[model samples]
Target chain A: MSLLVVGSVAFDDLETPFGRRERALGGSATYFSLSASRFHPVRIVAVVGEDFGPDQMRVFEGRPIDLAGLSKVKGLSFHWKGAYGYDLNEAKTLATDLNVFADFKPDLPANYRECDYLFLGNIDPVLQLDVVRQMARRPKWIALDTMNYWIRGSRPALDAVLKEVDILLVNDAEVRELTQEYSLIKAYKKVRALGPSTLVVKRGEYGVALFTPDGIFAAPAYPLENVFDPTGAGDTFAGGFLGYLAWIERTDVTALKHATLVGSVMASFTVEQFSTERLEQISQDEVRNRLALFSDMIRVEDL
Target chain B: MSLLVVGSVAFDDLETPFGRRERALGGSATYFSLSASRFHPVRIVAVVGEDFGPDQMRVFEGRPIDLAGLSKVKGLSFHWKGAYGYDLNEAKTLATDLNVFADFKPDLPANYRECDYLFLGNIDPVLQLDVVRQMARRPKWIALDTMNYWIRGSRPALDAVLKEVDILLVNDAEVRELTQEYSLIKAYKKVRALGPSTLVVKRGEYGVALFTPDGIFAAPAYPLENVFDPTGAGDTFAGGFLGYLAWIERTDVTALKHATLVGSVMASFTVEQFSTERLEQISQDEVRNRLALFSDMIRVEDL
Candidate 1:
């Protein structure tokens, strides 16, 4: 099965309480491709610049990924610098150098258009919808992730895209911000009303919750002793989630619940080290073991 | 199997963003006994006063619980008044009347002395250790819960009790304060070093995590649409956790994970209404359905 991902491929400088890293290979599409390539062949539809080098390309070279859709423009790749305070959950942007990424347009390759699964990582919501329009045949499942920036800056575009996607993935705070509801249950109901049948609320450190019209299911974040850097954790989650659906060829309620777990397992590896350091070395056994651990973490007995 | 719970039984006046309720029946022991009675017979060792009436006692009258250990003093029962801010997780005490509970000295019945499971709810740590000493036989599992007050005002007594208990249940903030560790995982490790085999870090809205020498597990709080009052939710969680273990006769790692789920289930019911209102009307089916929902909430597939 083939999966298509659309977003920016960039370099980031991130500082956390643990330490700081400069010019780390990061971005939503970069993380998503690395994670999704583990389950199925991924076709990446993103724009980078001349500065984007072999080291970054090597991160996904051996994996089952096709970067034919990756376009190279003649300038710096999207660059971002950020710092995390005591509340690691929130990030403060120190600088942004969009360069080629700011004015770039996503052009899907012929093979990518017919991919079975599509992932719209955090990006311009209008562009996300435009990518869907460019598809030759509608993918079996379309999953999209958004952030508070789009929710505040482009609500109309975000809401329009929400109606076109099959699933909506967002963080807990963003969910609350979009719905203006304190209770997650209410916030989920409000989001479901917008368009997507499935809504996954990602809670950093706490875990993720999958809500559908049928009911709500949740999975806790795998317990990690130390989180070196939280960069790319969310996109990695979306990757695991959508990639699993592509592998299983199902997006039913049952499959979506399973996808949330897969997402959680993938994210656990992403947070272990800065960028995708530890995620690159994760074995199938480690993923399976953590999935089992997730099962045990929330198992309840008949009293 | 029999379980003994020693804590406060009081009348609480609470105000929240939802509304206000005056003189609602609440207290640590009250919630603990009600939840524990569902899994096994519970013997409550607590003190009320002349104002404590049959109506309040009726909450547990028909359940498989023995109130013989409850004592009625000559004065008014303990009255606690508190208000919750927008967050609802934090409460500010407006007034506290210790009343009969001020001088509480637990006198366990002969049968209660041989109980296998004991849950010492939030109270004076010195008195909690005293109850342990009064037990005829060393209980197989002893669980203790405490607040920041004892962590500050009664560190010596709290430390003494920690060395003797099998499990320590505390909120995340309290755990951080107790151990002087900002990280929850580090805090759990610090608490474990104090002698308890297991430590539970409760995050009010986020949920709870169990840390044992063998492994670690966590469960998110059951999402609720409307939280009428969060009073006694933690104690209710303890009741469900300990009750499940006492009923199944297991205190191993597996049981600890199961207990966390049970605790989460019980806490869901506790927050539905003012103090024990929803809990009083809870049916076995309700618990089973919630457990099934929780099971669904955490279901995920192998990637």
Candidate 2:
């Protein structure tokens, strides 16, 4: 099963306690594609800028990624500047320049219209709906990620896309904001009522939790001694999660549980470095080893 | 195996989003002894004032709790007035009248000294050390709990108590404050170097995590739609955790892992209502059922 991700391919200026990087190859789609490509082929429908050259493209090279729909436009790409204090869980956004992304319109290629898995990253809910409409056939799974901005500003549009999504990936704050409910269980119930059957509440350092009608499953963040940067961890988590599901070709609870762990394992690596540096260079063996360790860490045997 | 807990046992006036209770039976040792007594016999050593009458004592009735060390002084019992908002994770302390607790001197009974397992609740480290010293022979396992007050004010006393502890259970903030390490892994390591081989970081709502030289184990809080009050959750967790260890009579990593989940299960019930109301009325069947459910929720089958 093929995976299609529609998001941004841009640059980031990151500063953390460990180190700093400028003009880092980033963006939701870039991280997602790199991470998902590790397990399955990913078709990315996102726009980059003219500044994105061969060096930047090399990050996706040798990976099972389709870039036909990744348009290289005339202007600069989406650039974000953020700084993290001692608390890596929250980032303080210094600036966000939605250059080419402001007037951006996702134009999926013919082959991408039939992707089995579709992930609409954090974007305008109206644009996300447009991407969904462009799909020739409904993908096997549609996962959408939204932020507080969209949830608060353009709720009607956001609700429209959410109705068509099977899984909704957003941070814990976003879930609370969207539902206006403090209790996570109640918030999840309200979210499921809106449409997406499963809600993945990503709690940065605390870890990620899955809320579904069947029950809830939670995985703690891989205890890391050094977190260099946390820029694209959420997107990387989605990529790895959807990628694993596509690889196994299963969306059942058991598979979703395992995929959630896989997603956590992938996100663990992303925070070790800035942007997609670690994700681009990670090997399958590394992922498998971490998955085994993580499974051991969280698994509780029968009494 | 016998378990002995030494901490404050008194009254509480609590206000939460759900409701309020005035002069409820509460305290660290009260919650810990009740939660632990479900699995094993518990001997409690703490001071309550004359106001703690038969009704207060009845909270521990029909349970395997020894009140031989429960001293009834002339003055008022320790009373705490607190409130919780929508975010139940943090509580606002409106008032804390130590009363008799201020001069609490834990006088362990002869039989209590030989208990196989011991838990020193968040009390004066000096008093905790005194309790440790009162033991005829060292227990099979000794766990200690502390707070930022002691960490910041009584470093020497805390360090002294830590040296004699086999396990240290404290919340995440306390861990960071005690070790001055931002990374939890590092903080756990630093804590291990101090004394206790096991560091149980009790993350209130996010859940609890165990950090040892061997590895780390994390358990998410049970998904609850209604959390009436989160007053004694951590104490309840410690009780359930050490109680399970005593029940199985094993201190291995596997036993610790299972115990951690059991602790989470016990704490889940504690927050369902205020004070010890839920803990006192909960049946073993309910605990076992939830433990089974929790085990199933966290268990990851082999790929």
How does each model score on TM-score? 0.92, 0.98
Best by DockQ: 2
Q: Give the Cα-based TM-score of candidate 1 against the true structure.
A: 0.92
iRMS of candidate 2, Å = 1.2
- In model 2, what lDDT does residue B143 have? 97
Please provide, for model 1 over A1-303, each residue's C-alpha lDDT reduced to its tens digit, 9 standing for 90 to 100: 679999988899999988899989889999998888888888888989999888888888788988898999899999999988765787899998998889878887776778678999899999999999998987877889998889999999998989888888898778888999889888888887888778888888878877887787776688777787888999999999888888988757778777888888899899888888888999999988888877665555443
- The Cα error of candidate 1 at residue B3, in Å, is 1.4
Which 10-residue span in candidate 2 chain A carries the lowest summed lDDT? Answer: A294-303
**Clash count for each candidate, listed in order shown:** 3, 0
Candidate 2 chain B: 10-residue stretch with minimal lDDT: B294-303
Q: What is the DockQ score of candidate 1, to 2 decimals? A: 0.46
Instruction: Look at candidate 2 and give me any clashing residue pairs.
Output: none
Task: Supply DockQ values for each candidate.
Answer: 0.46, 0.75
List clashing residue pairs in candidate 1: A207-A221, A217-B297, A218-B297
The residue ranges of model 2 lying beyond 4 angstroms of the native Cα positions read none
The true-versus-predicted C-alpha distance at residue B144 of model 1, in Å, is 0.6
